[model samples]
Target chain A: MRTLTVELGERSYPIYIGQGLLQNIASFFEKHQITKKSPLFIITDTHVAPHYLNDVETNLHKAGYTVISAVVESGEQSKSLAVYEQMMTKAIEAGLDRSSTVIALGGGVVGDLAGFVAATYMRGVRFVQIPTTILAHDSSVGGKVAVNHPLAKNMIGVFHQPVMVLYDTSTLQTLPIREVRAGLAEMVKHGLIWDEAFARWCDQHAEDLLALDPETLAYGLEKGCSIKAQIVSRDERENDLRAILNLGHTLGHAIEATAGYGEFLHGEAISIGMAGAALLAVQLGADPSLYTETKRILERFGLPTVMPKHLDTDQVMNAMMHDKKFKEGNMVYIVPKAIGQVYIDTNMKVSAVRNMVERLKEGDIHV
Target chain B: MRTLTVELGERSYPIYIGQGLLQNIASFFEKHQITKKSPLFIITDTHVAPHYLNDVETNLHKAGYTVISAVVESGEQSKSLAVYEQMMTKAIEAGLDRSSTVIALGGGVVGDLAGFVAATYMRGVRFVQIPTTILAHDSSVGGKVAVNHPLAKNMIGVFHQPVMVLYDTSTLQTLPIREVRAGLAEMVKHGLIWDEAFARWCDQHAEDLLALDPETLAYGLEKGCSIKAQIVSRDERENDLRAILNLGHTLGHAIEATAGYGEFLHGEAISIGMAGAALLAVQLGADPSLYTETKRILERFGLPTVMPKHLDTDQVMNAMMHDKKFKEGNMVYIVPKAIGQVYIDTNMKVSAVRNMVERLKEGDIHV
Candidate 1:
């Protein structure tokens, strides 16, 4: 197993990446001292459980670990307050306590929802993340666990780090084509924002990475998680350096909210957001070549590089105005200066953003 | 104002205790660097808004602050998931941003509900606690913000500290007799668990404390807050010393849940929990005199020293078993050995608890 540690002082934990580490999940728990006399609660979803839950239960039971499971329906809807309330109910009914552990075994939705349940259950509890999707490579690493509000995405949550993130890449073998493509967007983002060499490497091996070559995918996951871990360590609460992680998130979140969630995957929306942000950067006097390169690389990975046709500038603008990044009426954008470099710009003119959105809405950017 | 710093490193904040500080709320905000150009969202309740909301808003406005108000109903019902969702919607509608401040201007319910809203709104925002009740002296000092779940009290929440706790003692004068008595339960708990001198002082001055004598109440508030702050500083997440703060809360929460939230005041429920805890301690070979003294002091303050008639031993036991503090089928009780000293006993036998409850239910202890 290739392990990368997110150094967060006492709150630090490791991200384990390999093809079939789920079979050895017991040792990870043992090494992390997560052993409890009480039965550990396995929080998964309907879809994931049908594939891996019984295998995990058998492995854990073989290790003499009693498990209580809270399985919800498989989707973003499970991340609601109502579902969260149900998770709590199931957990308590299963008799999980402070001494008990919670293992979140699913994709981003399960990770975010279960991590949040751990964060607030009796103030807090110990939990491990066993991410089953490529998108979870991003969500499971950071301690930002939240559920969506009807009004906003990830509108409610906390920064509760997991004891460990066991990323069994074998699970990715079953991920749908669309999900794999979605995950690559964030991986590409990590490289673009922090490592030019890594970004170039990803560009060279795009096909292999997309085809799920275990070694190539593992290398990319490590690079992405390492960068995220470093950023989160320095600013766990996103005070300054951490805000860079939101490079495309400002406009990205706006698109998702406007289009309505599930219409576009998180990373898919973020791909389009990265394009808008690059344009914003060029307008702010950054090199235009970087925008071209970013769009090229995103397109190579089968991610969208242009705004959706139906989403008008007005809808996008209205959503952007309410974004969490927009503080005190100022739109904050994490603009890319060049590959491997980005800076936060708070002085973006609304008219310029409007102009870019209007052009993108009318397919004028290509012209 | 008498200020006590909570000393939580970067998360450290001050507890300002005095009369008439609400009129100078702007100074407190400035001093804590919670200055925001955006309008402050003042979250108050119907009961508290009439008396102090206008005064606080007018003063803030006079000091060149813009304000938005969200008035919730006055009670535990306001600490629901539905209410939390509404709070989020209202804050968003009010255009609260990362730069905006949330001022919780009521008692514990307001502090918990609003503080939680601040904890999760846009990830988080700076919040100040303008406590209008004596019970808030405990809730506001510690950063344990939460909204209650239908299944449990305070089952969902986070440890988000406020920039400052502006405890305006002047608001206590308007407190009803029942509310005043309720608030004293927590104050007496702080004394009983940590300081013998404070406990003795409380015992001697129970009448004065209940009458809302400004000097005595202020002294008690400062002492109670200091002890809580010290404990919270050492263990912010209740890993160890902090769990002691849950002294009577295990059964206290259980009682509240069993009786229905609003049926029994929080402090009233805790009052009985404290009595039960003392009895359990005596049974466990602690000083019998301690239990007698503890029950006598609680009686002097007009706090309940017996279980409510409607709640039988079975109901209390069932609730306690599901308490967040229970671990591995073992009920964990923070048992007081004497005034000013307590130890966590996690190996209590269920039958012993059952026996104690049976005796208490039959009024056999007094006989």
Candidate 2:
């Protein structure tokens, strides 16, 4: 097993990355000192519950922890106030208290929803993340947790770090190929934002990663989590360095919201958004190769490099207007300066972002 | 204005207490470094809007600030997820961005609801608390913001402090006498837990406070806020010392929930709970004078010292089981150890609490 810690001073926590760690989950609970006397609330989606809920519940029960499970529908739609309220109902009915731990047992959607619940339940409680998707390698590492607003993405949320994250790479084998391909988008984002060699490593290992090769997947995930942890440790609240993590997210969130969430996976939207950022970098006098290489690597992972042409550019721009990055007539964007590094642009013009979104829909943003 | 700072290290903020400070609201905004570039979203309830909304908006407008306001129904019911979702929708529609400030321009209900919106909106924005009621002098200082779950009070919440709290004592004149009496519950509570002199002062000046005597109210409010700020500085998330502030909240929340939110003002329920705590303390071998004095003071303020006989003790107990203070077969209660001091009883038996509840309902909890 390989472990990396997100160094948040007193709030710091560890990310455990390995194969088949779920089989030995009980010992990890003891190691982490998560109290067994309080009722445990496990939040998983329908997609993940059928596969792992029984094992997780039985193991905790065997460890003498009272267990209650809430299974939400599996999608971005599940990240709504209605579902969130229902989950709270289940938790209250099951008697979750201040000391109880809320465990996210699915992918990014479950992690975000469950984390938000933990962040607010009893004015904050301990949270545990068990990432069952490759995409969560990046999300589960950061303390940012949120739910989508009908008019915007991730509009309601808070920064609540988890006590620990357990990633069993064996779970990757159960993912559909499409989700696996989409998940690589965030893995690549970690590289695009800070690590040049890791970006190249991802490019070289694309075939192995796509085939669910456990060793390759585990290594890539650990590296992605490390880069994310390093960034979050430096800027826990996205005031400065952490904004770099949102490289593709500004435009990416708009695209995902425009597609009504499920139509385009978050990673796929981010993939296109990253291509746009790379293109904007070239427009700002970055070497045109920056745009070409980002596109090439994304395509190699089978992520869509173009936004859907049918979606209105104006609608996407309107969605961007509601994003956290959009300030007074400008966007606070993380634009690529190079393959391995990025810089934040506090005054990216609205007209320029509109043009970039227009070009992305047309698939003509190539350098 | 007398200012008390809740010294929370980097997150510390001031509570400004005085008469008619709302007239100079714009200057406080400038003094506090609240930005004017982004649209400001002010959340006030219907009860407060007709009285002060236009003045607040016009004052900001005169200062070159753009402002929007949402008026919710006035009462505890407004602190529901449904209402919370509506407020978020309004804030989003009003174009509130990352740098925009959300102002809670009402009492504790609005503060908790709006503070919650600010805490979660865009994963949090700047928040300001403009308190208009005596109850808020206590709540506005600490950053415990939340919306009540259907099953229990404050079942969903997070501790996100405000940048500053503005208390305008002149607004107290508009409060109904019942509310004024109820508000005294917290003021007296501060004395009960931390300052014996303040508690006796509240008892002595109950008539003046009930009549909206501005000088007495302001001095009392400042003292109360100072106590709250001091305690919050020591324990921000209720770990040890801070739980003392919840002196009557455990049973108070249960009785309030049993009555349904609007049937009893929060302070009224807390008054009965505080009396019950005094009774419990005497039952545990404290001087009988403690119980007599607690009841005498509560009655002088016109606060209900006995729980409603109609309320089912079992129903209140069940509601309490869903509270944050509930643990495995016991409760973590903030019991009155003596006048001006309190202690947390982490292993208080369930049966003893049940007996106390029965006695409270019967008006026979004399030591």
Candidate 3:
């Protein structure tokens, strides 16, 4: 196993990445000084429980943990106030304490929801992310954990970093094809924001990654997590540098909210949001050629290039206004300067965004 | 206005305490470089809104802010998942951005609920506390903001500090007598935990403070906030020194949860919790005389000596397990070392707690 430390001083923790990390749960807990006597709460979703919950439970039991499980429904809906409350009730019922470590074992939805539960449960507790899907590579690394409010997606949450993350790439073999495609979008995003070489690598190895080649997948996950770790360390609370990580997310969040969650996966929404952002960048005088190339690469990964046809342009504009990135009542879109560079631009106006949405609604782009 | 800084480095903010601090809201905004166009959301509750909302709103408006207000029902009940969600929706509707600041203008309940709203809303935002009640002298200074779950009080929340705290002591004159007594308990608590001189001062002048004499009241508020600021600065997240602030809260929270919320003011519950903690300390070989003095002083202030008769010991014990301070399924109680020193003792077992509860139930020695 290779360990990467997310340097947050006392709040710092390790991300153990490799095969069979799950089988060595005892040592992982020992290293963190988390023992069986510690109130250990495992959070998994409905879909994940049937697949891997027993293995996790048995391993934890063997390690002498007084383990309890909180299984939430599997969907975007689970990232709501109701589900959050249920998880808290479960933790309370199961006797979770401050020293109790919560193990979140599932995909992006489970990771975000469970991480958020740990963040707010009894004013925060230590949590470990045992990500079971390809998409969790992004969610598990960043300290950003939130649940979606009905009015807005991810409107409620906290930046609670995990104590440890065991990203066993072997788990990705169970992920559906669409899920793999969604996960690749974030890999592409990591490249677009900071690393051109990684982007080029994705361009060359997208098929290999889709085919579940552990070596290529592990390489992508490490590079993505490393880039995210460096950014989060400098700006854990997203004061400045961390905002860059939300390159496509400003518009991506709006698309997710407008389309209604679960209609488009988070990565899929980001894919289309990146397209909108790229076009907006071109309109605002960024190089047109780089924008074109970025869109081309996203399309090659089987990600959506256009907004959902049924979404109302005005509603999407209203949704963008609710984005956390919106500053001074104006939307701040992070646009690309080139394939490997992005910048936050707050000068974008409502009318300009409206016009862009109108163009997309009119089907002016290729599918 | 007397300005005191809670020195938490970059997270540090000034607490402006005195009469008519509300009039200087514009100046505070200027010093913070906050502009009127920033998405500003003011969170208040029913009890406080009728008195101070207009003045706060007018000042913020004059300062050129696009101000929006979110009001919840006034009480401990407001600090729950249901109300938190409603406030989040209001923030979303008002277009609150990450750059937006949430101004919490009420007592501890409102401060905690609103501060938590800021903490989780968009994964955290700038929040300012404009405390109108005396109880806030303690709550506002510490960066501890949280909402209670059904099974546990403060069972769901985060440790997000405010950008500034505007403590307008003039607003306390409108408070009820019971509320005044409740607020004084925390001041007494601060003295007991860190300053014996202040504790003696409180003991001597308890009647003057109860009468709301401005000189005595202001001095108490200032000294209490200073001591709290010192502790919080050294331990913002309650990892060590900050836990001292929760001196009576372990059992206090359990009693509050068991009795059902809104039945007793936080200080009242804490008053009982302190008594229970003192008894436990004496049993564990700390100074028994110190425990007697604590009980005497609390009784002198008209705080409840006995746990409310209706609460079940088992239920309270269950609630204790949910406290954020509980480590390894064992409750960690903050016990007094002497008149002014507090030490965390985590070695106590549940059977000892049960025996103590049994004694309290049997009317053993006036709590």
Candidate 4:
């Protein structure tokens, strides 16, 4: 078992990663002092519920913990105001109180939605993040839980950290092939933005990660979570340095919103956006190798490197304008300077970004 | 203007209490470094918009600020998921970004709804509280912003503090007589929970307060805001000392929810809950004067001292069970030991509290 703490003083919590942790979930709850008095609420999606819900429920019940679970649909569309309210209804009906804990037991969609519910339920409650998909290796660690607005992704949320994060690698064994490919987008992002060596390691270990090789996958999850935990610890509220994590998110979220969510997974949209960032970096006088290096990595993972031609550049720009990162008339674009490093260019012009996004939409090629 | 700071270190903000401050809102905006480049979104309800919205907008515009306004229907019903979604729609439509400011320009309902929108819009933005009702003296000071669920009040929200609280007493003159009375309930509660002399002052000056006597009301607002600021500074998240601030809110919220939200104003419902708490205190072997004295003062302000006879005890009990306060089959009741002091009782029985609530409904002998 490997453990990483997010170090948010008084609000800090541990992330436990290993095999079969879900089967021993009761012991983790006890170790963390999550109260057994108030009924526990487990929020999972349809895909995850079918596989692990019974194991978790039976184990918790045997250990004298009262468990209540609600399962939603299995995609980004479920991260909406309607679903959020539905989750709140289930929580209130289940008699969950301040002491009750909400456990997120699926991929990124489930983790974000459940974490958001835990953040605002009764003005905040205890939350446990149990990521079942590789993509959640990033989302699950940051404590940036939110529901998407119709116009934008993650438009409504709070910086609500979890009491603990329990990641069982056993769950990753069940991920679909495409989900596995899409999930590696963020693991690759951690390297692109901060660690050059890890970027190289990902390039070398791409086949193993895709095959769900236990040792390789676990090491990647640890490295990804550790980088995220370190960044979130320094700037929990994203006032300064944390914005670097949004390297590909600006255009990535725009692509998702314009494509009408669920057409492409979150990591897939982000993969395209990261590709756009690299191109924009080259246009902004950064080395062309930066763009080549980023695209190479994303493609090696079988992720999308180009935004589809059908999605209009103007519509995507409009979506970017509505994002939290866009302030005043300027887009807070994150530009990659090297494969392992990025910088926040707070004054990126709309025209410059538009020209780069247009290049991606038009499939301007460089190998 | 009289000022009191909420003393939360970097999150600290000032509460400005006086007349005509709204007319000079641009100066306050500049004083607090509310940017002029990003547009400002002011959320007001129908009741407040007619009298003050144009004045605030015109002044801000004249001072070179881009102002956008959204007027919601008045009262507690506006604090719902539907209304919250609508407000977010307006925010996005108006092109509000992370650097933009959200000004809540009404009473508690507007403060809560707008503050909530500000708290989560693009994962939060700068917020200013421009309170226009007496009830806001309490709600505006604390950063507890939320929209209510069908089953519970403030069941969905966060602790997002504002850049400043700008309270212009001039707006209070337009408040309906009932709102004046309802607003005094919290002011009286601040006294009941922390300061004895303030309680006596409220009792002695009830007539003056009801008449909106400037000197009396101003003194009371300053005192109420000061006590609230101190308590919030000590415990921002309601982990321990902050729960004391919910002295009457446990039953207060249940009464509000069971009555279907708009039927009773927040302060009025809390008024009846305060009366019930006094009755419960006496039942728990505290002095009978605590009940008599508390009831007498609430009545003097024309606040409801008894729950309606028609509202079923079982339904109210069920609603209380859904509250953030009730937990582990126990009611976390706040009992008054005297007119001035209170202690949190963590282990009170649900059945025992059901009896007290039944007493409130049956209108048992008192006074």
The number of the candidate with the highest TM-score is: 2
Model 1 bad stretches (over 4 Å): A362-367, B362-364
Residues A157-265 of candidate 4 have per-residue lDDT tens digits of: 8877888899999999999989999899999999989899999999999999999999999999999999888898999988889999998999999989998998888
RMSD (Å) of each candidate, 1 decimal: 1.8, 1.4, 2.4, 1.6
- The local distance difference test score of model 2 is 0.89
Worst 10 residues of 4 chain A by lDDT: A358-367
Native contacts matched by each model:
0.66, 0.78, 0.95, 0.76
Clashes in each model (backbone N, CA, C under 3 Å)? 0, 0, 1, 0
Across residues A10-100, which tens digit of lDDT does each residue of candidate 2 receive? 9999999998899989899899998888889999999999999999899889988899999999999999988889889898888888889
Over the stretch B1-367, how does candidate 2's per-residue lDDT look in tens digits? 7888889999999888888898999999999888889988999998899999999899988998899999999999999999999999998888888889999999999999999999999898989999888998888988999999889988888988999998888888898888888888999999999999999898889899888888898999999999988998888988888888888888899988988899999999999999988878887788988888988998999889887988998898888788887766568887887789889998887788888777776665546
DockQ for all models: 0.69, 0.78, 0.78, 0.79
lDDT of 3 by residue, B1-367 (tens): 6788999988888888788888878788878877666668888989989998999889888878888998889899889888888898888887777778898989999999999998988888888999888889999987788988888788788888888888888888899989988888899999999999999899999999988888788888989999999999888888878888988888888888888888889999898888777787777777778778998888778887677668888888877777768877566778888888899777668887776666655445742
Which whole-number lDDT from 0 to 100 does residue B290 have in model 4?
90
Candidate 3: lDDT of B363?
Answer: 45
Question: How large is the i-RMS for each model, in angstroms?
Answer: 1.4, 1.2, 1.2, 1.0
**Candidates 1 and 2, the one with greater DockQ:** 2
Worst 10 residues of 4 chain B by lDDT: B358-367
TM-score of 1: 0.96
Q: Compared with the true structure, what per-residue lDDT tens digits does model 1 show for residues B1-367?
A: 7989999999998888888888788887777676557879999999999998888899888888889999999999999989999988887777788889888999999999999999888778888898998899999987999988776778778889998888889999999999999999999999989999999999999999999999999999999999899899999987778888887788788889889889889998888888888888888788788778888898898988777768866777787877778887777888898998888887878887777666555443752
Better of 1 and 3 by TM-score: 1
The per-residue C-alpha lDDT of model 1 at residue A105 equals 96
TM-score of chain B of each: 0.97, 0.98, 0.96, 0.98
